[model samples]
Target chain A: MNLHHAPSSTPLVEMVDIEKHFGGIRAVNGVTLDLYPGEVVGVLGHNGAGKSCLMRILSGAMIPSKGQVRINGQDAQIHSPHDARDLGIETIYQTLALADHLDAPSNLFLGRELKTRFGSLDDGRMMREAVDVLKRLNPNFKNLSDPVSSLSGGQRQVIAIARAIYFDVKILIMDEPTAALGPSETAMVSKLIKQLRDDGIGILLVSHDMHDVFELCDRVVVMNKGKNVGSHRIEDVTKDDVLSLIIKGQLPDDWVPRSQETVQ
Target chain B: MAETDRSPPLVGWNLKLSASSFHKLSALFTLACLIIVFSFGNPAFFSINNGLTVLLQTAVIGLLGIGMTLVIITGGIDLSVGSVLALSGTVTGLCVKAGIPVAPSMAIGVCVGAACGLFNGFVITKMRITPFVATLGMMLIARGVALQLTGAAPISRLGEAFGVLGNGSLFRIIEKGANGFPKVVFPGIPYPVILLAIVAVAAAYLLNRRQIGRHIYATGSNEEAARLSGVAVDRTKMIAYTLSGALAGLSGNVLMSRLITAQPNEGVMYELDAIAAAVIGGASLMGGIGNISGTMIGAFIIGVLRNGLNMAGVSAFIQQILIGFIVILAVYIDQIRNRR
Candidate 1:
């Protein structure tokens, strides 16, 4: 298998020959990917296609059995989520994993709460930062004080994104962010993803939504049956190519397809 | 524009008022109801002396309840507090018998209590033992140790200075007698009562204003989330247990000083009383929501119920039964309010 290298760009994060196994089952085998600065890479796969597993390894939620992870050309030893955070890697899980009882500011500051002179939580500062971050991500988000439980799915996603961005995350891993959202919410998330890319954050987004991949992601990496099948630029590949990779586990060798559909 | 019109203000003045008032008013409502019931039932219930007696009696349990409130808010229970108290009192007795100074003996008692708390914390956090189970085991062990230390009997003959903690008044005043009657008035501030107040105030400040206090709530509310957020979950849990144990020890020592004896059987049912006080004060058994003030009120409620029952000629067994019912009722009320 020939590997293409984008040598002009210095990748923000690179995983070389990554291998992870759960007991006897090989979850991810010999997968290598690079996320460049200001790029959103879509990881497309079916259920149990090792997409989540690979992302988990990247986020340091789980350790890879073999292979090395390098951040900005430095070897990274990420054994836990805290270690991931130290490296500016943050993950927003499908469950969102947010504390429902806490309001936005509290959730944003969770374990690393800002403290006042008296050593209590600096609520005013946290609130101010939360507001500023939310406005930059989505100006329509106005209810910053309400408990996340009371917010709509879209609002919760916005808060989650805001949390990662405010922490100055260099690599953001989002798992099925729009899985439970409506069309309008999906659009809002798409817009947020674009904004995050513009801020030069490297994002690894795992999703089943082909439309989201085509619309928001600069490049798409297709995974099938626990292996990296191929990576394609959005400009060079069509939706049919991605779907074929996901279904047949490989791109067609010689299929000429029509091009230049109107850009929506 | 349509969406903005539909959405309510993030936080309205009325909504904030209602939320704060809801908790304050519920506590007020319960207090008012308790007063009205006791006043109507017994004419002597509201007497100054009777009130002072109730406060003195509630002080020890109130101190334990404050600690329990913190522990329970962190989603932990300390069933061993009663046993820890007995052990602490026993240690104080042994110290005095061995000719240790009264003040130092008292300090040793408190240190013993803190040791018990540290042990409980270690077992729960490092060993990953459930708080209830670990404390239950510690409770049995502490009780057995107390019994063994005292030879399963009462140890009397405490130092005079120690008695001042339980029985002696801080101040005394002479008043004029009416119609050739002689009257002597002692301020009637028991040392335990004073200590209880100090501890309660300090606990309230710690729980409500300090970063450690916030960590306790965060740990109790959602432990995994707390850890992810960088709140040391194990350390917070350890602090709660240690505080609970130390206070229990203090309560035991005070009880012994008041009675002028270390009775092995004295603290047998004290844990129930402390737990009831915490629950009655609105500290949820599920944790992450409680305060020292609420716990003090709960201790008073228990004290009043016991005092009122005695005045009304209720048997001791019946008083226990009534208290059990009240605890269930208070917890039920808390559950309903939380659901809303």
Candidate 2:
């Protein structure tokens, strides 16, 4: 079957006509958006506004009932989180999905562990890699062997991000990445996001923090009541505009909402 | 991060050692206390022959307990284990009676046990039956089948070679001895005890070193999380139950061989002992924590207590009451320790 191939200059990640329903409730209606390589796209929506559901679809945690996902111009069929990972999509869930009793290195290598020729896990290599990855992201981090339960919430979040990066993910989907972090840790995470973008990885950031979006994202998409409201370049839209679209389901008159508001 | 860097080497060592080492030490302490109490209560308990006797008696139950530990660790219980034991033993007996070789008969017994476990696994996983209810049903079915197979009578008179498994010693001793002054030649240990030790070691290694072992722990700890992380939760549970059943079957064969008869009612209430041994050994019913050494100690504790009660000439009925009290006390102590 011949599929539509986006031009070389097209965005690295694209969703078209995406729709999802949970019985009678439409969680995410028809929505379409594009994310370019080396760009962070902030998704803004109120609670139950379909931000998480959309992100879940992208992360392969949930499949859309209708629509298509394309990564690097190739059609991606992501039925499970592993499928999403195989397509170079990594998601750091808000819950973190961490094994509390396991140390950082073990948590980072939970399912897809590095093994020696003898087939046993290569702890030395895994620990070294975890240390290196953490150091690169936050030089202050030194406890690679500490169980995540002992770590602060920020540290656990960092380890989750490190896990995604170590797996060579090209697209990172973070759900409320800084929701529970202290101000300092939030700044640290913001810095890390910039560094990841500089390294040319695509990012879909779902957050309630408007400041974080304005500071880090290059573009922003607004969703309201299971429908895409509008997409705007970072410089072209204010936080007020995004907020209005999310809460009011309408953009300011001068900033007319896009006609393709309802997801297919 | 700072905790490890600035902590004194001795303090760090103590902290690290305390977490894992304390559990081992506690188990050993209990074991030592049992040995002392038993030997003090009965002079015969200190004899090597008595030790061999205790080990032989505990072997089948101990083996069943090992598998039960794994199942219990996964937050699941197998009430059907005793029934599976009877069923497998009957199958082995029937096969042997039909002129099947000893090895193949044993294999069939183990296979039958494994099949029963698979059924339990399937019912729980696919049919969404709770482990307790499903295994309870299985218990009745297995026990009924066992009774039906033997026509409600015990099957006896197995080959002498089979009898050697339970009744015969690895080495024979020729001795001329009286109670006060006696010269007794040494006899080798029972092969069953050696077999039990080997099985225990193998179980320890599997639970500690293998990926399959980790999967079992993970499935027990947080099954949804484990499944989300790509661990095959259903398959792991299936393996746990299957292994538990198969081991119970093996234990049954040993029990039958020792008794030289297939007693359908012999294993009644055995699942309770196996579960109690597992729990007392630190295999939490909540799942995600256990060790072979702990279970072995638990088995020894049970064995020694029984021996001590017998030597003390305690009534059989009172022995049961004491055992029940001991099980409760052990569990109560464990809960207190866990809280601390």
Candidate 3:
């Protein structure tokens, strides 16, 4: 992880003390996290660890039981995915959230489609734009008219990523982006994440891959049993230390604790 | 590169047809085969009069199929269409009896259907009822309402202007043959047939060229994904169901005009025919796979088959069984095509 540049500006996003409950089960306890501009923060957790729930709250898929989100130091009311999208927050869900029957251009501009002066769908223009963005991510992508269900997993992943960055996105929430990808595809995604971060976009990367966290993320946050275990700069903690945090929600005995507010 | 290797080579018309397009066209191919076979079975089946008769016969069901195609493509089934058609006709009949003008009365009838569809949409989306159960309930309710409204009576002898909507033709040309026998040059086209053509073209335009159409497909393809993607899934479904209702109402008007009467018990089992046409045209009950042109052709197939069978003196019961078998065959072929 690169540590040369400091966060000199207001953090791009501040999710403060978010809590969510499903009936008697607490899916996410009070947890707070901050992301600065041009940084990738890896959220590490096992299944049902509440990391996905926390990210979903920020993505506006679920309303937190108690908490608020601030974008650029301003509170935002994210009640639906539409609200999040308007705030330049995009999420690539673990399922990719793609309608399988539609073609590339249709999926790329699913809800927010471009229209001609006659108020009809501007399919030609959309096709061109989809192709351009898709080629940027994977140059070899071709079958532009085929239904997305016919595409390979890697290609579908590219479509999901393309959808997230196709517009003027300020923040991106990726839930297990590389969980289903192979070795070469994983490398491609890592490169894309770095590229987007370099473009000044704040990214919350939810993953279980320690190598991915160690290599790509500037900071790491771990959760266990719906509670935040710890937050650390990737350079300050070893992979095993982060793994222990994910599994047992513990920190090293000799490690000095940074104040919660100043950790970022 | 590996992905490219998995897909067929993107060269030639074969690739352009794809699996879905082929499935849609299969219906057209079947229609052609049926026409050829029927023409051979009965020479009169190949005449211009028979062709016109088939189009006239198809008008009501074609309109119903247009709406059915839209609803089915949205992954919904509207079982109340036949009942709604009867209801629309009876309502229009009551309006005519009350001395309402022809055009406004027709519009009111279509609107009534639209309102019922809107209510269905509201119940399914807001009240969280499955479309199947909701529409089945609507079927019973609409039929009962239609029967009760007219007291199980038939409204007959509507005005001359109303009769023109279903029976009138344009550009008729007849010449006196030898021995003073009248030979028909052209029968022109029935108003209902023309109406079906216009509605079908408009429907095709909406499905292929509009944003709402894409949203409808997306909603049917995957509702959760559409919601997450910012599609107003409920609104799309409402539009689909509403359109279905309006089209069914319009079909009712045409039917009433043709019979010169509106019977409370009319249009029983018509919904099944509409569904059959849509399915035979390539619309899947599972949703997100259908087209207007395919549906219209599918309607014509039914019309032609019935006319040809009648000319051959086949029993009505046998024709019914044949149509049911054809519907199953069409869906089976589509499934096989898609599985490839």
Candidate 4:
């Protein structure tokens, strides 16, 4: 087991040599990655490249077959998504997971619905809160009472992000945040990512779109076929260099995989 | 991905119409049209006597329909509800015959009904059986077991208290008639009607206000999404089926109290009527799209249709055909609405 010790500046989250296998298929091979506070790290890869698989393990949506997840320099247990959320980790899935029949506040607080003194849903208070949060994310937004199904794609994305932040997120994982969005929606998401990073949350974003990686990310981590090739500062690398790493799973001349490998 | 999650039906002139309100309005409109047509066909259909009768008759099915709405909204069906009702009535009858007190006997019957529902929930959740097949199997098994318990004979000899629970009225402002029959000075609420109203109020509050209720809707709308969000999908479905069974049991008790007997064959096909009322009220078999008030309206529609047709000299066989057609029509409308 790879244990992380405290330095007060330890990365917000560290995944040490994670491995996941499904029957004969090794979906995500041994991979190590770290997320620091107040930085946006992009995971770039082709389809089926295990970008989602790695993030899902970190989010506790799926368990790693082998690895230790250290939170704030201490080993933490993440058995389920609820546990992940309780530890101040939230994930914005590509599917967007909104209850289409529910209104904005309802979708924003789906499982963790706010309750009144009598234990009933406090819709009035929830709507008031939803209005406050949603307005800051999208200024021209007005349909707080409308069901999410009728909302535009960008509005829905805003709702998803608003949900995570409202829950007091410390580490945010976004999978393909702008994959289904138009240009305006993409820009909105990009802006939201930068704002979240500025607010001191560690963000792990998975994307295939090079524009989103360059526009919103401080650093890019490329993976191919379930293995992390390397992590690079965006300022030090060009788009083509990262593209080559993603397509060929090649390591940079000075870069090396994290020092330790887990024993079987 | 954008459209995959938006499965709730959309209607024309519906962009502003929240799906729940739209369905409620359409159901109310249908109920109104049915009432007007029936009233025109027979003037007696609009009379106070017939109205009371319709409301009273709506009690049994309406009670089951309330529970059915909850179950259906979770995207599951309880075909065993009618059989569970029969079993509960038979258990109550057996208790009374064994010298048990009337009140406790009925409570035992209701508990037994809840137990039956729990069993259904267990099979579906723990054993991983599809609800349709599990409840279908339970329907057959429960009816057969109920018949076996009673030796295929109806239990009679229930006393005066039995009559009181089923036929008693609230606010005793009545004078004894010439034959010692009670004649009311004021319109009073029947026990069954009172129970129906109380149940509907409580159910409406539970479905609309509570967290479990929200989880139910979430589970039905998208199970995987709900699970990921920390909603207990299995627990929600279990509660839905169990509540449905308990309601079916209570309806059966009220039914047996009125008849003062437990017939092994009683409550046969009652599930169909309850499901039909729920469907007519806009509860989707697909789940997550219904309300109890609309279900009550649907039950009233069924009651009016049956009473009006009978008053119009329509045969029972013809009434069955008409009901079947209405069920079909409601589903067809739902399909078109969902597609749009």
Candidate 5:
């Protein structure tokens, strides 16, 4: 992905020293991360590397055992997904978070549905808007009224992405957005991520795929064993460099994050 | 933005008919076949008198099926419906016998049913009990209460007005016959049949056009997903079980009126009939699918089969066996359809 980053923008979101423990086990520890407008920041980690744990805290699906999450430079309490959405943070989960029996419009507006003047379900309006949003991502998609169960993995992912974008997403968190897509579908999703980045939306992409991280991200955040190793600009870091950070939990000695450059 | 090295997405449209639609249509076909076979077997089965008789018989079970449809659509079941029915009807009968006004007594009966539903909802939602277990407990509790309410005796000699609700007919006409004797035609529609129609219309409207309807379907389809999506999962589930209780109450009242007495055993095993009717109507036990029209048709099919079999001198025992087999078949077909 050829991502053009606009320098020195306000932080759209920041999680400071987030810590989470499930029973006696530490799932995430002292992980701090942030996003700025018009940037696709890849959150890279191997399986069970606290990648999802950290994102869950930001998504309001789980409360951190300790730490603070701030949106737009203000402290935010994300007690639930509703709270996260209210903060303009939308999470398109890896599993898609869709009811298989429900159609696209229903899933897109599952929690917040459009209503007619007299208060009936404004399905027609929801469908039209869903078609519009879906067309932008995958114009060839046609099964607007069919349930997600009838859809292929690629189509379901597109629907999930449509749901996040339908809302005014300021900080989009996509967990493995192209895990189920074919080569062509992956390209479509790769391009969609770029389009969202161009739209001035800050995205936190959680991916284990190196190609996805290198192609779609402007900046990369690596995590290993419940801790953030480091963040680096894609141009300044190689795939092997990020891989070493993911595997060894240490950054290259000469490399410095832009945030750290000012302090030193 | 990076350009992808692939052809543009191939946009195409195909209107594929869903499997659920096919199953529901198949239900209609079954009902048609039942009608044809019965008509050929018994000449009386095709008569208007028998038709009304079948419709009247269907009314109580049909009402119960309406509530069952809602509950089943939300992926819940109410096993206490039969017990609740008896209790509601007995309460109404006792009230009427005590010289309370008929209208208020009947209203109280319906309220009793709704209250039982609310209690079931409370147990299932607040107590965090599985709906099947909660309702199963309620079913036994309700049966004991019903038995205690009457000491296993029937509440008899209910008020004239109260009996009319179950036994009375609406829109009757009286005319002078050829012998100049006053001849009175049975009411144009049995009161229960008319009541069933009113309730069915209301239930249909709620299921098809309301926000609550969609929420119920969503909650039933995938509860965790619904909760994450911000649907009030608890409230939607409660409403379904509560509605089931209320409908069972209405059925009990109708049964009491028709029998001209409230017996503790009035609706013994009636839950099976209500559930069977809903299933035959195309409701999925797994939830997220059903329609009132289909349920109505389903109820009629059951009613006609029972009455037709009885008229043909098929013993009641044999009738029960046949109905049980049919219910099994319906559910099996539903499972097969869902598998595909």
Candidate 6:
């Protein structure tokens, strides 16, 4: 795959030596990953392989027991989802993280609500903006006032995407973006990922789908049992090599690890 | 997959009158029917004097219902409101008897109520106690404190000026008599009714148009999702409980002023009435659904039934049973509408 950034540029996000312990269980133990501008990095792992746990720490849902997360080479302190939003980090959780009873516009502007001069919620202006962003993402989208619980799964996913892109997002973390979607909806998401990547946004895509990683990711990192098995360019490693690494946490004898002069 | 097939719009614009509003309209209809039937039962029930009297009687419960609406919308219960009302009244009565001005003394009463609410919020949020248990404990503690303060007796003999707040009417007309002396014409809307109206309007604005209102609803609807979306769930819940407490305090003062005394054992089982008013007006106990107009109508419904039944020679015992049945019927209807 073609490199999106020059080697001299600093990585947008660097999480080094991350460790997370839940009592006796070390969910994530000593893993490191780097993401650069305009690149999609796929994190592939089985259930309980620590992919979700590691990403949760970066998303500010959980704090790292031992690790340093640097943004633009500067050490950051993120203790909550509010702090993460201030640093332009938005996470689209697998559950979608939406209040099911609120309307479309209310959910789209849940945290970052726009207020009129008189200090009331600018519902009219918010509805207009929601219409603008949602139409571009899903042209068939309607019912701006209906509760999100009444929406279809694909439409709800589009609303969640609208929320992330509606703000000034620098780093987007998506956990299983298409896990519950149909084939057409999945294709729609793949198209959206490419569109966002081309627009110079850094994304951390965590999934168990091999085809999604091969088609949309530039670099793929495999994790097994809380450890990084290997990292390779999508073009350098075949589907079977990545599969073997994910299952056994072992790299083939003939395969060389990707160079990391720029990563460290 | 046939998953692409969209369900025919379950809520159309014509039918888009949300289930909440539809329930509100139905409640209004029920209230109108009750008035008509009672008026037929007794001619006095249809008079303007009786209408004003019913509203005056509803003022205390209406105030409590305002706070109850907020608490219920956040999916929490405040069983201590009635007891807090008694405590606030006793505190204010003591302050007035101690030579403090009535206005500031009343303000102190409301503040005392707010403090109790703050304690309840702290216990529920920081201490991680469930709201039902926390407020239930507060109910007993506040009632006990009120009883201890008054030594199981009522405080009375407050000055005449203190009674004006609850008994006076707005816009009283004065006319020059034949001998050039001012003469009383008409007594306008009662003070407590006007106060209830003002509080209801303010609470409605806060719930429908403000940021905190959204936070309260979101927190009640799905707390984990709200937290992940950057809402201050703890702060929102605290505010709801605090507001509920303040309103209860205000109600205590109004009731005391009207009766010209503060009874240590007053407001017993009053919490049940406040909760009933909210539920009857369409505020779901499950939270994330309610409105002030509905609650006000609900308060009036209870007041009219009680007043009209007394006039019609029905015993208070039967009235209680009927009100209880009405509460159950309202919730059951809400459940059926939601299922559709």
Supply the TM-score of chain A against the true chain A for every candidate structure: 0.89, 0.91, 0.93, 0.89, 0.91, 0.94
Models, CA RMSD each: 5.0, 5.1, 3.9, 5.2, 5.7, 4.6
Which is the leading candidate under DockQ?
3
Chain B TM-score of every predicted model: 0.91, 0.91, 0.93, 0.91, 0.92, 0.93
Superposed Cα deviation of residue A70, candidate 4 (Å): 2.5
State which candidate, 4 or 5, has the greater TM-score.
Answer: 4
What are the TM-scores, per candidate, against the unseen true structure? 0.87, 0.88, 0.94, 0.90, 0.90, 0.93
Q: Is the docking of candidate 3 incorrect, acceptable, medium or high quality?
A: medium
Clashing pairs in 3: none
Model 4, residue B213: what's the lDDT? Answer: 80
Query: lDDT tens string, model 6, B1-340?
Result: 0000111244455565666677888989999999999999999999877888998999999999999999998889999999999999999999999999999999999999999999999999999999999999999999999999999899999998778788889887889999999886766789999999999989887877788987887877778888888998889999999999999999999999898798778899898999999999998898777778888888988998999899899999999999999999999999999899
DockQ of the two-chain complex in candidate 1: 0.31
Off by more than 4 A, model 6: A1-5, A253-264, B1-15, B173-185
DockQ of each: 0.31, 0.28, 0.52, 0.33, 0.35, 0.38
- True-vs-predicted CA distance for residue A39, candidate 4, Å: 2.0
lDDT of 1: 0.80
User: Per-residue CA lDDT of candidate 5, range B1-340, in tens?
Assistant: 0001111223362434456556667887988898899899989889877888898999999999999989988888888899999989888888888889888887888888888898999988899998789888888888888889889899887757778888888777778899999787654688899999999998887765577877887887888777767678888888888888888888898999898898888888888898999888878788777778878878887998899898889999999999999989988988887787
Q: Weakest 10 consecutive residues, lDDT, candidate 5 chain A?
A: A1-10
Chain A accuracy of model 1 expressed as TM-score: 0.89
Which one wins on lDDT?
Answer: 6
Cα error of candidate 2 at position B33, Å: 0.9
**Arranged by lDDT, best first:** 6, 3, 4, 5, 1, 2
Q: Which residue pairs does candidate 1 place in steric collision?
A: A111-B229, B73-B288
By DockQ, rank the candidates, best first. 3, 6, 5, 4, 1, 2
| lDDT comparing candidate 3 with the true structure | 0.86
Cα displacement (angstroms), candidate 3, residue A172, comes to: 0.5
TM-score of 1: 0.87
Shift in Å, residue A150, candidate 1: 3.9
lDDT of 1 by residue, B113-146 (tens): 8888889999999999998899999999899988
Worst 10 residues of 4 chain A by lDDT: A255-264
lDDT tens digits, residues A90-110, model 1?
A: 888887766664567777777
